[model samples]
Target: MSSGVEADIALDAAVVLSLGMNRVLGRTAGLAGRGAEALAALAAGRAEARAAALAEAESYDQALRQVLERNARIEALAETREKLDAEVALPEPLRPEEQPIEELTAWCAATDQALDGAERRLSERLAAQVAAEIFAVPGGAEGLRADLGAPAPEPTENETYANETYRTLERVLARLLPDATADDRTAVAEAARLLAGIGSPEEAEGVITEVRLRVGEANRRTEELRARERRRAAERDAAEQAEAERQYVLGSITSAFEEMGYEVQDGFETLTAGEEGAVVLSRGSWPDHSVRLRVDDAAQVRAAMVRTAPARSEDDRRLDVEREREWCEAFEAARERLGEAGVRSEVTWRLAPGVRELPVSDGARQTGTRSAQRERSREREK
Candidate 1:
């Protein structure tokens, strides 16, 4: 009995120990699994935190750009509203029904156009100002220190076009004309004021001086050109007047020659181009001599014809006078081209009327025609 009791106590103690061991083993396994899961969750949380930080950093550039764009839009809207008000006047008396409906409609349209234009201008200006602040002021000061007109500071790649164009302009101008005159120096200083649309005293002086010089030269050239034109016009008038007189004389000479029954000689027209309209003349009855007209063709021919005076037919004297008339026309045409005083030549002729002489020739078409016409006239008269 004592042995059985001892064995039972030992067995009970072994079972209790096994149960406790099994519980401890199960608890240790569960704790290990839970620890692994906690480690995985910690790693994921650290990664998520890092990703969030990266996203925030990336967004800053976009945010800053947005703020600048918003500021520009606000300024543009404000300027547009003001501009529209300025351009379109309200109805007179500021009262209803005082203005025409058409005028009111036009005003509204003008106001809207003005607003649009102003908005565009303001947008452009705001963009410029913002860019200037960010780029021009700082970059320009650096340039000023680096001999102002030297090659520009190197630009950051893709870092906006900002002041690059202005910098490039200065660098190009510096190279294009390295050495400058007083005028060039003045141009440079004035260029800034002009670009900015600011009325500067120094710039204004340069402009005024340049304008004065140009205006003075313009006035002088204009006066000289005008004087030359006037002289040419006067000469033309005188020449035309002389030509008129010459034509008159030539007409008279032609009529007188035909009437006098004197056959016209060739080379007569050639002599008309000469000074004083003189030509050499000779005939079967007259000695060779020079003849010209004083008042051109008309006066000379009229003198020769002497309309009121009865014609005296003498072949010798008539031939001499006819030769002189041809020469005068030649002289006048020459004088017109050269525009100089013509040399005088002595040419003489005697005039005779048409009635005293009669001739019969196969060559004289006028003689036949005149005779026929005279017969016709006689018949009519009868």
Candidate 2:
């Protein structure tokens, strides 16, 4: 019995030991499965954190690149502004401060008004300069104004510089060319009109040159015409003076001859009196004698006596030589009578038709005196 009881106890102890060993093994296997699940969860979290860090780093790089690009664009805009300033020779525009959009807009509007005012002033100055240069030319202001078709309007308080200059030019032209012809006035008016339209001084100079040439030509023509008229007047005056001298000499001589007891016939060679009033003389007592007298402008006198041959017979024509001697004596007595009457005379005689002058002898003069006395006695008896 004791041996059997001991065997049962040993068997119970072995079974209990086996049961405790199985429970411990099951608990250990459960702990090992829980540890492995915890490790897998931790590893998943680490992987997620690493991915978030990488995403953050990429976003920062993108932001930095954008800022750099914006800075580059601003620098480019500033460079362009500087280039514009240099090219235009303009002062730099005021930069706006960090302000509200409304305030900035107001500032821009004010700046624009200021720039407009400056532009107006500059234009006025340029116009004044051009006008001054044009006026500096000789007779330029008057010449240009005359070229204008219409008279310049009176100046007004608000008139532009260009308009004021045009008015001044018109006045100058009026004073300078007061006697201009219609054509010249028209040309000047046209030129002035064109010059008024010109904007620059250079263009005005070209027009002035052309206008001056036209005016000079017109003046020269006028002078030539006046000279021609003066010459004609002088010629007429000289002719009138010469004709008056001739008439005075002829009248004096005709009256003088009438006082010498002779009938005066036509003047010598001409029907009318000439510069020297030469005349024919006839007396009833001297039927076959021919006498001529001449008076000069200086009142000097000369006389000539001639004899006529009888055409009825050749013998009478041959006797004309003796009659010519008697005529020569009568001419000497007539010369002495004229000298006593305040006229000095030169007497000449021709013996025949083609004969020249010859002097009378003292015997011929005595015969002529006897013939005159006989003619007086015969007249008294009748």
Candidate 3:
């Protein structure tokens, strides 16, 4: 019974330490365990037995605490690994299966910081791209940056109002630029260059208010000009705008494939009465495989894996299947690349691997279908 009490006291001390409490053996809270051990020693009245019991309790206490501490660390490391796994791909050495808990925790912190920096850089690049699209003329990203001038310094607390006011002015001026005269636009740009040095709201209010008045005047002149231009402009159908937008989107898609080192042939006809929009892309690496992008009237885009040459043997068939699988990966990557280029796309439908039905000779099928469609269109025109 005395030995049992001694063991229980030692276990209780370990429980306390496992809760991350301070070392309890020599402290006030440890008195109960220590007193029990001493009492057991005295009651047994055998020096050898007492020494053995003390050694046993001390060993149990140390072992139990170590186990509990290790368990806690393992639990924490596991949670960190799960979060990192979901956030980004784990590096080779930091992967949980590759190393122990201690090393993973140390490496994950660095990886998390690196991911943060990468995301920030990507965000800046996207912002710059958007700014170029809206503000720059064709091939004018660098010129637009020059026109916008250098970035303003961080505003002090006292200059917050002034800074926000300037930003508002800049946004409104940019929106009005399409209608404003070159001279008026230059005036606004010059004002922006000069105002970049001003910090006080009082000093900026006059220049900002003057810029606003100029923008309002420009808007009034634009309305008047549109009234005259409307009389001279021909009435156009809605399909014209839709076709232009479709062509623009197709151009972006073509650029994305070209950037991927594929040769693009965008024979995109206007989506008039019965036209089918198609683009073909091929790469030298896979001479026999080509990707056909089909855009219908509804503007839904789909990629077909085209086997330019028919398979003559079983080995050729196997190679064709492998090539199709590779095209699936490339098609998905192309969509992602389009997003980076500011073109958003969503997959409406896809046939999974081993489920797709491909024609024996896609090249022949494509040619016949396109020719027949054109012949029908010509008949209709006649």
TM-score of each: 0.25, 0.35, 0.32
Q: For candidate 2, write residues 1-382 as lDDT tens digits.
A: 0000000001111122222222323332111222223323334556455345434333333333333333333343344334323221223343322233355445445645554444333323322333444455664554333234345566556545556555554343423222234465456545545564566756756665555555566546645654665577557644543333333333434555455556777564334435246666666755654455555433344455544222245554444445455545544465444333223433232234224433332334566678779999999999
How accurate locally is residue 272 in candidate 1, as Cα lDDT from 0 to 100? 40
By lDDT rank, best first, the candidates go 3, 2, 1
Report how far residue 314 has shifted in candidate 2, in Å.
Answer: 11
Best-to-worst ranking by TM-score: 2, 3, 1
Looking at model 1, residue 245 earns an lDDT score of 40
Q: Candidate 1, residues 1-382: lDDT per residue as tens digits?
A: 1000000001111122222222323332111222233323434556564345334323332333233333333443554436423232222211222234355445545545654555444433332332233334433423221233135566667422433434432332232111123343344333432323314545534543553343344445545654675577557645643454443333333334434443344333234444354322223432233222233332232122111122235654475345445433433343232121111222243322233322222223444577679999999999
Quality of model 3 by C-alpha lDDT: 0.50
lDDT for position 310 in model 2: 24
Q: What is the alpha-carbon lDDT of model 1 when measured against the actual structure?
A: 0.35
Tens digits of per-residue lDDT, candidate 3, 109-163, equal 6655654443333323322333444445554232234223367667788656655
Candidate lDDT values, in order:
0.35, 0.42, 0.50
